[model samples]
Target: MTTKRIIPCLDMTEGKVVKGIQFVSFRDAGDPVQLAKQYSDNEADELVFLDITATVKNRPILLNVVAKTAKEVNIPFSVGGGIRSVSDMQLILRAGADKVSVNTGAVTNPALITECANAFGSQCVVLSLDAKKVAPNRWNAFINGGTLDSGLSAVDWAKEAVRRGAGEILLTSIDMDGTKKGFNLELTRTVSRAVSVPVIASGGAGSMQDFADVFQTGEADAALAASLFHFGDLSIPELKRYLSEQNISIRRDV
Candidate 1:
């Protein structure tokens, strides 16, 4: 069985990691570079650094911060936000990122996904979808840091992105974001089944069972959380151990 990945996300702004409920009411968590090292040292399978406000600000990704954080961790690092073109992705990759995730930029220009995959291989292009449930078993993919709806069905977009050469899908439930209730299992499972690529489930992680549930029931390839790991509510090591006990195949070498 493939070992399920446990990833800690760094939602960043002004060069600092921050967290909020449902993507608002933000508060500082810690320095991105410092936290990157800590999570990498503590056995996180991967680190995702998202410049949450970069698109809204109409700026490029913070390459300086990405470089600093990348240097601190040996694990695979994925950076997202404000990446509008292949050139931007090259800049980020040159800065030490293993992969580049595109959200708003990809929505506006679906061809960008193909361009990125062609330039850097599909494995290096991740489609980051911020999905909000609009009805039962229905979701709309949002962009601009979950501030704008792209009028695209989240599941449909996932399939289209993968067909266009996105190697992975980073699916986050805006409704469940920071709620700590649990992951949006239905939404996750739907997308996971729709896509042929690995799907990383994000949002609503509050406990260890949440991780197990997402993997076992939701069928997510990976589980990602911010404040749960950022606020020390749970440790990656502890969660991995718990998942192992639950018979979830996880990377114990971390």
Candidate 2:
């Protein structure tokens, strides 16, 4: 079995790392490059830098920070937000991002996903989804940094995204964002089963048990958390140690 991954998400706004609950009332976290280097030097399996407001602000991703952070980490790093075209993906990849995640832009024009995957190869295209539970076991995809509901079925979109050549899914639970309760296991499992590509579960990670639950019960390939890691509530190595004790094979050497 492939070892489950533990990733640290760096939600950035205005070139500064920030974290917010349910995607609002944001607070400063730290510098993106510093956090990237910190997670890289630690045991984090991967790092994700999401320009959370880039799309809403109509600005490009912070490439300068991405370049600096990319130099700090040896592990895979993904950059997202304000990525609307194939050229944007190319620029980010050239700026040192191993993968480019598209959310609002892809929802506005899904062909962008195909174009990016075709040009950069499927491995470099990541579909970042912000979903909220509109009904029981049913989620609606959100856009514009989780402010607008796209009226797209989250599960259906995941399948279609993979069919369109998206290599991975970054599934974030809008209801669970920074909730610290636990992941939306039903949503994660539904999307994971709907797509062959790996699903990275985002939001609602509180404790070590939350991570274990998402991986086992949710059958998630990876669990992503920002506030927990950013606030020093838990460290990647400590989380991996806990996962190891639970018999969930994870990369501890990183």
Candidate 3:
């Protein structure tokens, strides 16, 4: 069986890691590099660094921050936000990102996914989709830090993104983000089944059982969380040990 992955996300804004409730009421977490190093030491399977405001601000990703954080950890890391073109992706990868995640940029120019994948290989490109339940049966894609609704259904967009060459999908539920209630498993399963590439479920992870739930349902290839890991609510080593004991495949810390 494929071992489940536990990834900690550093939502970066103004050079610091921050967390918010349902994407608002932001509070400082800590230095991204310091937290990243800690996760690395604790055996996190992977790391994600998102420049949360770059896209809304119409600025490029903070490559210096990426470089510094990448230098602190040996594990593979993916960086996202304000990535608009193949050149933008090139700059990010050169700055030490193992993969570049595109959101608003890809929404505005779907072809950018193909361009980046063609130039850098699909394995190096990720499509990060911020989705919110707009109606009982519909989830609309949001962009620019979840401030603007793209009016696109999440399922349709995931399929299109994969068809356009995104190697993986990072689907986050805006409503569930930071709530820690649990992931929107329905959304994760829908998107995962809609696309062939690996799907990393994000938002609303509150406990180790939540992680197990996501994988057990086959709704996500990996579970990514922030507050639970950032606030000492959960430790990577302890979480992995618990998962292993539950017969869930995970990479245990050496």
All candidates' lDDT scores?
A: 0.88, 0.88, 0.86
lDDT for model 1, please.
Answer: 0.88
**Each model's TM-score, in the order given?**
0.93, 0.93, 0.91
Q: Candidate order by TM-score, highest to lowest?
A: 2, 1, 3
Alpha carbon lDDT at 123, candidate 3: 97
Writing each residue's lDDT as its tens digit, candidate 2 over 1-254 gives 78999999988888888774232223323677877877888888889988877753534448888888788789999999888888888878998999999998899999999999889899989999999999988899999989999999999998899999999999999999878999989899889888999999999999999999999999899999988987778888999999999999998782
RMSD in order of candidates: 3.7, 3.7, 3.8
Q: After superposition, how far is residue 188 of candidate 3 from its true place, in Å?
A: 0.5
Model 2, C-alpha of 177: deviation from truth (Å):
1.1
Candidate 1: tens digits of C-alpha lDDT, residues 1-254:
67999999988887766774232222333667777887898889998988877753533437877788777889998999888989999988998899999998999999999999999999999999999988777899999889998899999999999999999999999999979999999999999999899999999999999999999999999999988877777889999999989989888761
lDDT of 3 by residue, 1-254 (tens): 66788998988887777774132212323667777887898889899988877743433437777888778889999999888888888988988989999999999999999999999999999999999999996899999889999999999999999998999999999999978898988999989988999999999999888888888784689999988877777878888988888888888766
Better of 1 and 3 by lDDT: 1
- CA deviation > 4 Å runs, candidate 2: 20-29, 55-61
lDDT (C-alpha) at residue 157 in model 2: 91
TM-score of 2: 0.93
lDDT of 2: 0.88
